[model samples]
Target: MEVELEIKGKKLVLQTGTLAKQTNGSVLVKYGDTYVLCTVVAEKIPKEGLDFVPLTIDYQEKAYSAGKIPGGFFKREGKPTDREILVSRLIDRPIRPLFPEGFNYETQGIASVLSYGDENIADILSIIGISAALTISDIPFNGPVGAVRVGRINEEFILNPDNEESEKSSLNLVVAGTEEAVTMVEGGAAECSEEILVEALKFAHTHIKGIIALQKKLGSIAGKPKREFKVEHGNLKDAIFNIISGKIENALFLQKKLERQQALEALFNECIQNLNTADKDISLEIANAFDKVVKKIMRETIIRKGVRVDGRKPDEIRPITCMIGILPRVHGSALFTRGETQALVATTLGTSEDEQKIDSLEGEIYKTFMLHYNFLPFSVGEVKPLRAPGRREIGHGYLAERALQFVIPSKDEFPYTIRVVSDILESNGSSSMATVCGASLSLMDAGVPIKAHVAGVAMGLIKEDDKVVILTDIIGMEDHYGDMDFKVAGTEKGITAFQMDVKIPGIDYEIFKKALDQARQARLFILKKMYETISQPKELSSYAPRIYKIQVKPEKIRDIIGIGGRVIKGIIEETGVKIDIEDKEGIVRIASSNEASALRAIEIIKGITQEVELGRIYMGKVSRIVDFGAFVEIMPGIEGLLHISQIADKRIQKVSEVLKVGDQIPVKVIEIDDLGRPRLSRKEALKEIEGKNISTK
Candidate 1:
């Protein structure tokens, strides 16, 4: 079966029943020659004792899809790349919420790129394929979600813009939704206004509806009967509520996260003891009942009295403190604390050699600015084995990096490579946003010359029937209970990065607009607090290596490099400096902690690449004597021919009669031949010196 639609003059094609027939559900999505094959499988029975579904989305990009072989030793794709992991999260976030509550089946979805045309990206197509596959299969799903990437290029919205178009665009907004409302939003912009973001959302939804209609058409003919699944609701709610009742609400009102958590744990213990049941099932029932009551009371209190768990208003932010230069040895360091969350961020400056190289399907690219986020087990007060960064850490780091990327200086403006590391010292909620704040401060502290101060805030939503409450600067508990987690980051001018994921089916336009506005206000407030500590970039740290830049003729690049880089390496060794030379533009960067060493390296490079000008005088050393002329070394690598006729006013018998090797004498560059060789005259240089001396007398 096939369903096709033309979006923004590009064809979107969906086909099924011809491949992966053995799987429970499978679909192949094609957009502008890029194809994604998505398949989903779920166990018939739920995992025993599992309260949540164990679903994993693996989105892999096969090298063969792009007509290239894998570069590594194994010659095949190994672990998931960061791009794959992020795209997998994109597909999982929207679809996971559509599954019925209490469906704890262990499910897995795999989206493989079958073809990479480079015209259309496979990310959005993967989401569409997964949604279509689940809709047609026996698996229970309440979705035919549509996704579109919206790009704005001159205030006009473009749907699913190609890679080239995306570069020219200011906004790269990916919106995913069911037919009725948007479910997920993830992408970044270049400091665009909030209203502009809203318009983009509305534009994306229009195209999204078309995608949903196409999915529905495919499902109508090939949809299978949903499997029989029963959601068991506990009847112990009333029975357990009598035991905890008024105590749960008071426990929730505790000011601190630790205190609130301890109070809840104590109440759960009391409730379990009051039941006094040896039966394990009764204890589990009591636990579930206690959770439901806590959730209900928290929501009710917030809606009725406009009070939060921490005794703040719905829009109130937590107390924040920003400190800089905390670490003496590092290039730049800052400690940003907001309520219980804190991030210790440090920045380091390096030369061009420190740039990161990324090999992807498109091509190889180098990144001069990098941000790394580390979340230790101790930060959350948990004990877990230390290992490589998990998916969550990478995702958080990428978001914070994107948020600050807009403000980072260009390579031409600031030649040094910049790296920012954010360590989560303490985490209750919004550690990622705290990282953004700390990173911005540290960049300024390192004298990065970023455009503006960037700040981030995590906004949340709690909806009960018609009552929707938008939360600003939410803590961990509110985030866990809320229906939406919307993170927005930017400068005071506009937004730079944004991501939103909702547990509910979807959110309408009104909620989206309100969430963005609230997030913007929160971000500005945080920026104001950050500026109180440090406003602009300061002087470069004493520990940082000073870089001196100079450009030479492109042809002279090879001369400076010499055979096997011997010439440049010699300069670095003699002066104790680091040198980077660009071949095309001949831009040489000399970096050294010692100012004298850097200047000396620059002098050596200039001498090696300098050209001799006609009619110019230079102090020359006679390097070799020949019958016709003598070779004089004017610069380090440049030599000029001083013929015997031009050596003196009258002709001499032999070149050695007037001058010999290793003689230092002033000479004039009389002429330069066609082959770029300079002819030198010692008589003319001596006459000019004599005339100047006579005038002074």
Candidate 2:
């Protein structure tokens, strides 16, 4: 059966009962020509000891969907790209919380793009597919959440703008929610105002109601009978909470993080010992209930008493420290430490060859500016194995990359490929935002001409019946227990990147706008401290290579690069420099450690391609001494014939008597034949040499 939903004057189609029937549930969602097949599967047996639900979301983009073959050696999709990982994250964030409490059954959801379209992005439709699949399956999902991409162009908001239209818009926001409240939000903006962002969310929710209604209609018929699973239920939760209520309040009152955690853990262990039970399951449930007691006390304290874990005001920012040019040998480096979160970001400048060549369904392209984020378990005071970046790392790195790309200079202005690697030495909360802040400082430290300095702040919300407290610069504990973790990053002027994940059913614009306003204040404060250290880009590191770019005639490119690259290779080998040439604009970029080598390479290129003047003189080489005349090389490859009379002032009977094949001598372009070859005269060169003839053999 197929259900149609009209949202913002656009038609969305959701169909089921046709594909992947073996799975718990499957649906094919189409918006215009774009469509995705989303399927969900739930394991029969529950996994053991999974503190959280074991759920995996995979998003794959097939090249054949767009009528193109994969470009790599495998000629097929092997791993998920950053975009795919991020979209998977986007779809997972909203629905993950809506599952039943303590539901730990293994579950997996996948969205496979089957048809590509030019008008819309596949990610938004993938969200719809996931909701539809889970809604009609036996899995207990509380909602059919609606996802939409909002755009801002000319002070107007657009819902689900096409590819071309989004490029021109200043805001690229993806919002997901049920009919009641928003659950997930992530996007980057062009310094858009906070009011504008709030309005976009409100606009998105109005249409989400229609999508939710359509899903419920399909779910009424296709939803399978709810599956039953057995897990021991415990009644000790209330008893454990009452016994630890007094100790937990004092523990949660401590100002220091580690200090508070120690206090709580000591009380929890003591309570377990007092129970003195041989049943391990009962003991574990009691321990979990003790932790819940802590969450409840902490949230209530902040809501009723207006006291935070750090004992700071809800809108207060943590102390900040910024330093740049810390590494003398690197291109650019900075250390940005805000409270406990620290990011040591290093910047590297490279040629165009360093750009990342991404092969995707759209086509192949290069990314000049890349931000790599690393978060080790030890950064949070834990020891773990080191491996490749996981999904969280990729997602955070992409967020920082999106924030900094806004202020980075264009390729036309700065041609070098820029890379910033942020290593989190310490983390408490909002380390990704810290990476964004540190990367901006590192770019300026490396003498990258950025438009403006950018800063990021993490905001938390504590909401009770009618009261709400918006916390600024939230710490890790607050983020883990708060209602919302709203991260907003941008310049002092406005927001650049925004991300939000909510724990509750939904958030209205009134509270959302208040959080943004609070974050704006925090952002300005952080930027002020950063400016005091280094306001703008300093002088580039002396050790860095000097880059020089120029354009020449398109026809002259062949002359510089001889047959089989013989001439350009010789220039690099002799001058000890690097050169890159482009065929489109005839652009040549030369990078060298010293100016002398760069100038020498330029002279070598000009020697071969320079237009020959009629009366010009050149120091020529005796390439071959023939009987008729010795062939002299006036340039690298342009040789002219020198007759016997041109050898010296005194007429020589034989050319070898005056010039040998390995000899160096002077020559003049006396005339040119009709075949576009130059004829040289040694006698005319001797007159220019003041009649002082020096013989060579």
Candidate 3:
């Protein structure tokens, strides 16, 4: 089966029943020349003892899709790259909330790029294809989700902007939603106003509705009947709630995160012992019920009292503290703490050689600035084996990275590769936002010359029927029980980055606007705290390497680089510095730990590459004696001919009479020959020196 529609002056085609037919559902989506094939499979029987949905979504980009082979010794795809993982998370965030409650089937969705094009990104298409696949499958999903990429250039919003257009756009927002409401939002902007962001979301939703309708049309004809599965924990939940409702409420009102957590755990254990059920697994059911009851109480408390579990009002923010220069060795370091969350962020600066080389389907690209987030188990007071960063960590890191990217100076202005790492020392909620604050502080602390201090705040919403409460800076409990996890990051001017995910169907424009407004208020408060600690970038650390960037003639680049890079290598070894020279641009960046070494390296490079100019006087050394003229070494590796006639005011019997090898004399560049060699005059140089001496006298 096939269906087609028009979106934003482009054709969007969806086809199924022709590929991966054995899967429960499959759909192929094509937009521009990019094609994404999505397939979903679900086990008939639910995994035993599972309380949460085991839904996995993988979005992979095959090198072959872009007509390129794998770039490793194995010559095949290895593991999921960061881009693939981020895309998978993008698809999972919106789709996970759409699954029917208690539908715990072991489900998996795979979206692969079969064809890649520069005109359209495969990530958005993968999302649309997966939504269509789930809609047509037997999986218990309440989804016909729509996704679109919105870019704003010159105050005009462009739907599904291409790569070139995205470069010029100040806003790049990716929104996914159901027919009535938006489900997920992730994007970054150049400090755009809240109204502009709301307008963009409205613009995106208008097109999202059309795509959702198209998915519905495909489902009506080709979708399989949804399977019948129902899970009932209501009776157990009510029984547990009856037993522990009072205790849980009191425990929740405890202000401290750790104290409240311990109190609740003890209460749950007590309730379980009191019930004294025979079925060993009944404990798991009771535990699950206890959690739901807790969620219920928290939500009700917020909706009824308009205050969070921590006793703060819905619009109130947690106490924040910012400190910098805690670490002596690092280039920059800062510690930002809010409520129970803390991030120890550090910055490191390097030369162009430190830039990350990413070989994506589009081609090779270099990233000069990077931010990495690390969440150790100890941050949450858990004991687990250390492992590599998971999807959550990567997603958080990317969001924080984008938030700071707006204020980071361009490479031309500050020619150094920068890296910021945020380590979560303590976590309750909004560790990612803490990372944003710490990263900004550390960048400024490291003397990165950013435009402004950036801060982030996570807003939450609790909606029960008609009552709605917007939270400014939510804690862990509020986020888990709340309907929304909306994080906004930026400078005092406007928003730089934001991410939104809701447990409910979607949020309306009014709610989103209020959330943004509250987030902005919280962000400004945080930024004020940060500025009090460090308002502007400090002087570059003495330990940090100094990088000197210089431009040379394109033709002279080779001369400085010598054959086989021998000359550059010698300079690095002699001065203890790092050098990166761009072949096309003739740009040389020399980095050194010592200022003297950097200056010495620059002098050596200038001596080697600086061109000889006419009428310029230089202190030259006579290199050798020849019959017609004497070769004068004007610059390093550069010699000019000082004819015997120009060597002296009067003609001499022999060249040795006026000058000899190893003799230092003043010489003027009289002319440059056709071959690009300078003709030097010592007599005119002497006369000019004499005139200056007389004037001074």
Candidate 4:
């Protein structure tokens, strides 16, 4: 059946009786020509006490939708791209939080793009499709959430603008929410003012409400009855009340931040310890309940009371300290700490040969710059087995990488392979932002001429009733209690990257704008502090290698390469330096540990390829001596015969008497054959010497 519904600010048309009818809950949704098919399926049985829902959201794009083909060996769908993973996260973020706690259902949400006009964004459409599917599916969810993409162009806000319109827009913000409040936001912007960001958010919320309403209307027609599920509320509730009421007086009066945490930990541990002496099976249950209770109280306290556990104001940033060039051996290094979140970021500069090669759907490619983020368990006061980077690490690294990508100089401009490594020494919240700050400082310290300094900040929000407070430079606690975690990163002129994840169905435009505005203010402050330490790029370290670039004629590439690359290899071994030669257009780049090595290599290259100049004396070896002339070898493969008459001013004897094979001689070039062979004369060499002697006298 075809269903039509209108909610908040969007109109959704879902046709279930037609397309993708095989899936459990498949609906083709149209939001103007941009179409998406959302399919949902649930596992027959849930894992015991999984606690959280196993909800996987996958957003895949078909090449045919954009009139392109898969460009790889497989020629079909493979692993997800970074773009797909990001879009999947976008669809998953708002929906994940909307599912009720303790609902351990294994559900999957897949939004596939069958047709795209390149006008509407697939992300916003996917959000609508997911909501529509869940509203109609037998799955239980506290949802009907709506999402919208808001942009600011020419000082005016636009909703669901086409791809072309988004290019000119300053902000690319996605806001998703229920009727009451927004739960998620994600966006990037030009360095817009705080007021402008706020206004854009408000505009988005008003329109998104319409989308939410549409989902509810669609559910009314095709929705299934929600299944009955137990929300576990055991005797732990009474135990939690007793513990909090008993300790509320002391917990509320706790002054020092660490002491408060210690006291809370002691209280929770005491409850667990007591439960351990009780029944063993119920002990696990009691511990889980106690942890939940403490978390609930902690969240409630932040929302009901104006105070934070860390004792900082909502808009106050943690103490920041930045230092550069901490590691003497590295090309560049910086230690950036905001509150407790610390990142030791280092930058290494290398030649083109050291550039990273990646195999992707687009085939093998070389990247000039790379950023890696490492989050060790010890950074967050935990211990666990070490493993490779998980999805979170990849996502975080890409976020920071995108933030700094715009400022990095192109390979042709900088001619250096750049690698940035961020190690989290301590993490509270927004450690990724610390990566950005550290990366910028480290690049500057390495003498990388970035266009401008970049900085990042994570803002948070707390909403109760109609009142909302936006927090700047949030800590771990604020993030846990907060409804939104909006991270913005950019240079002083414009935003480079942004990500927003909310705990509610969605946030309003006003809240998002306020958080972004606050983030900008905090970002600027952090940048200023960084500038105080080092305002501009310094000279590269003396230990760093020196690089030289040389371009040769395309036809001469083979000559320089010689047979089987023997010539270039010989040059490297003789000079004791590294050389990279591109044979396509004959561009040779030489890198050496010191200037002398580089210069020596350059000289050797010039001697082999440069044309012989007239009057230039070259030390040559006599190859064969005949009566008529002595043939002398000048360059590697060039030989010239000097006539016996030109061997001396007054020669009356055989040439062998004066010059024999393997005799070293100094020769002067007097003429060249039509074939461009050097004609050497021993008489001319003697005359030149006599002229120099006369001049000296």
Candidate 5:
């Protein structure tokens, strides 16, 4: 069966009942030439005593989808790329919240890009595909969510903009929502205003509603009956709550996080002892209900008391302190601390040769700026086996990179590869936002000439019974328990990047607008503090390599890189410097610790490619001696003919007596034949020396 809907003048086709029939639900969605097949499977038997939903969303991209072979030793896709992991998270966030509570039947959804059209984006299409599949599946998902990519071009919003349309856009926003509310949003912009962003969301939601209607119609035709499930607390909730009721208030409000956690744990343990049920099955039931009780205590405390666990108002941010140029040897470095979270950021500067080269479906790309984040166990007050960064770390680093990339100077303005590394020394909450603050300060300390100070803040929300509270700079507890974690980054003027996820069904546009408005205030406040630490980019460090850019003829690139790269290798070895030459427009970058070496390399390049002047004198080496004349290399590769008669003032019987291979001699450019070759003379050079001697007499 197939269902087609037209959204914003584009056709979205969803087809099923043709492939992967064994699964609960499978859908193949195509828009333009792009197609994605998403399948959902569920284990009917629920895992016992599981509180959190066991849902996994996987988004994978095959190279063959774009008519290319995979590039690896295994000739197959290995671990998921950063792009794939993020997409999986995008699909998981909206759908996970819609499942009925206690429905822990181990469901897995997989969305694979079968064919990628150049004009269509696969990420959002995959997001839409998973939603359609789950809606028609037997799983209890209250979703028929729709996703679209919005772009702002010439002050107008474009829905589901393709690659070409996005190129001219100032905003690249992706919004996912059902007809009732918006669930997920992630994208970047060039200092977009809050009003424009809010309008864009509304615009995207209107079109998304149509897509949702199509899914509902499709689900009614092919959807299976949802399995029945019931979880019994078994009088354990009453027993535990009765014992811990008196102590919940004091334990929830301890000013210190550790103290509060300890108190809550001790009280919960006492309640467990009061139950005194030795049956393993009964004990498991009590344990599960206790978690919900704890969440209820936290949420009710915020709602009734109008204050947080840390004795903060709803919109209060944590304490902050920042410093720049803390480390002497590093090109740039800063230490930023917000509340208990701390990030020590270091910036390194390098030559153009240090730029990272990446191969992707789009094309080959070179990145000049990169931000890497490292979250150590010590940062979180725990000890574990150390390894490479996980998906969370990569996602955080990419977020910070997107936020600050807009402020970085272009290659034409400041031509150097920039690397910023953030090491989380202490973490409590919103450490990724702390990274954004630290990276901005470090860039200024390195004299990177950033446009403005960039800072980020995360906001949290609690919604129950038509009441909502937006918390700014929330700690770890609130983030894990709250319904929303909305992070916005930007300068004081406007936003640069936006990322948000909700754990509830969805939040209406009113809540969305309030979050954006509150974040803008926090962003400006953070920026004010950031400027007091480091107002602007200082002078470039003296220890950094001085760079000079030069351009030669496009055809001369290969000549500069001689046969087998010998000529370029010799230059670096002889001068002890680094050089990068680009085939596009013949851009050459020479970087050296000292100015003398750099100047020497430039002069060497000029000697080979520069034209020889008729009257200028040059020191040349006699490369070969023939019967007619001797070939003296005036420069590296430019040779001139020095006849035997021109070898000496006196008639020489053989040129070998005066000149031999590897002999250094001064030669003058006397004339050039019509063939554009140089004719040189050693006799004329000697005559000038004799004339000077006679004139002194």
Candidate 6:
């Protein structure tokens, strides 16, 4: 059946029973020519010990939809690319939060690209489809959430523009929300001010609200009765309230930051000890509620008194300190701390072989730069079970990576594989921004030669009435109390990346612009502090490997490679250097630990390679002397036939009189055959000898 719905001043046509009918809930959604097939399937049982809803969203792309073939070996669909993963995450963020708590069902949401008009993004549509699917499914959700991609083009806001149009815009902001509030946001901007980001969110909300209304209308026609699960509450609630509320009032009054945190922790520990005698099952619930109450109190303090827990002005930033090249053995390292948030970032440079190979629907590709983020429990003054990086870690790492990617030098310009790791030594809020600051410093420390210094700052906003206060370099408490968390990063000339997540329905354009301008001021201050430590990239470390380039004739590429790569392998083994050779078009790169090894590899390459000569003499070895000609070895693995007729000034009857096997002789090149075979003459050598003899006499 085809369902046509009008959403937020746009038309949406969702067609089912036409494509992918096998899935439980599948719909081909069309907003103009861009189309996406959204399907939802639910498992029969819940995942064991899972406290939250296990909703997995997979967004995929096919090359055929884009009218392109997959590149490289194994040219077929593969694992999701980073871009796809990010899109999936965007769809998951807003909808996941809207689901009813304790709904621990295993569910999957897949959005496969059927066609893209090259304009409308599938991200927004996918969010709508997820809501639509759940509306008709047997799952319990307080959704009908709407999503929009907002862009600022020509100093004006645009909602859902084409790809080409978005390229010219300064901002690419994705906002997702319910009718009451925004739940998620992801975007990158062109050095836009905080006010602009906030305004973009407001513009997005207006359109998103319309979409949500359309979803509700559709649900009214096709929605199912939602199942309910009891949220267990016990006597621990009163105990949690008494323990947290008592300390929060005093903790909020403390002016010193560290002292206040200590007091809070002490209170929390005392509460935990009191709960030790109570039921173990309700202990965790009590702790979670206690944390929520603390967050609420913090928010109320900022809203009512206009004072933060740290006792700073509304727009004040925390103390910032930056240090570069902290690790002597590393290629580059930096320690960056803003208030309590600290990150130890390090960079390592390698050859092209070290690049990460990615598999995706687009095709196989190699990424020359990578960023990894790690967060330890100790950073937050907590003791918990240690495990590998989860989805949150991956997502944070990717955000920092994208923010810095705009300024990284291209592979051809800087032929080194770069890997950056950000370790959180302390956490308050905006650790991702801390990673960005640390990465920029570390790159400079490693001598990466970046175009300009990049810095990131997180801005917080508390809105009351028409008045709004924008806080710079927001801490953990401010982030919780604030209505908006706007993060912006860039160099002095322009912006690189920005993300905004709002707790309220949205703010207006004026507020968004104010926030951006305030963020810029904070960002510049942070950049200045960073420059005091390291102004420019240093010379590459001496311990780093050396890379050399060499070019060879295209035809001789196979000869250099030999059978099954034997020739290249032999060179590597002999010189102790890594050689990467391209047979087609002939380009070879040599990377080694020292200059001598690199030069040795080059020597071996030159030995097996052939060079064309117009006229040159060679000291040759006679391999065989026949009646008609003498075969002589000129260069390594190269032989030429010297005719007996041309052996001397006077004709000789037999070749044996002049030359013998295993004899050293001088030969001159007479001509080269069509096949590039050399033709030599002993007669030419004899004439040269006679001339020397006459000169001596």
lDDT of each: 0.89, 0.86, 0.91, 0.78, 0.86, 0.78
Best candidate, lDDT-wise? Answer: 3
RMSD of each: 1.9, 3.5, 2.0, 5.8, 3.2, 5.8
Q: Model 4 over residues 169-234: C-alpha lDDT tens digits?
A: 877788877778767766766565566656666777787787777677777877778777776766
Which 10 consecutive residues of model 6 have the lowest summed lDDT?
688-697
Question: Pairing residues by index, what is the TM-score of model 1?
Answer: 0.97
Model 5: residues >4 Å from true position, as ranges?
Answer: 7-10, 233-235, 280-284, 351-354, 539-546, 593-596, 614-628, 643-676, 681-697
Q: Residue pairs in steric clash, candidate 5?
A: none
Off by over 4 Å in 4: 1-23, 26-39, 44-52, 58-88, 110-136, 142-228, 232-239, 249-260, 270-305, 584-586, 611-697
Q: Supply the TM-score for candidate 6.
A: 0.79
Clashing pairs in 1: none
lDDT of 2 at 457: 91
Ranking by lDDT: 3, 1, 5, 2, 4, 6
TM-score of 2: 0.91
Which candidate would rank higher by TM-score, 1 or 4? 1
Q: What is the per-residue lDDT of model 5 for residues 1-697, given as tens digits with 9 covering 90 to 100?
A: 8899876566789899998999999999988878899999999799887877899899998888888887769888888877788788878877888888888789999999988887556888787888889899888888888988999999999888887898898998989997888988888999999899989999989888988988888898988887788865477777788888888878878877778878988987786677755664355666688777877888988888779988899999988999998999999999999987899999999988789886566756789999999999998768899887887898899899999989999997899999999999998789899999999999999999999999999999999989899999989889988999898999988899989889887888788889889999999899999999989899888878888888888777776789999988999998998998878788888899788999999988877677778866777899999987799988777799998888887888888877789998877789988876899888776676566652210
Query: If scored against the real structure, what TM-score would every candidate get?
Result: 0.97, 0.91, 0.96, 0.78, 0.92, 0.79
Worst 10 residues of 4 by lDDT: 248-257
TM-score pick, better of 4 and 5: 5
Predict model 3's lDDT versus the native: 0.91
Better of 4 and 6 by TM-score: 6
- List of clashing residue pairs for candidate 3: none
Using lDDT as the yardstick, the better of models 2 and 4 is 2
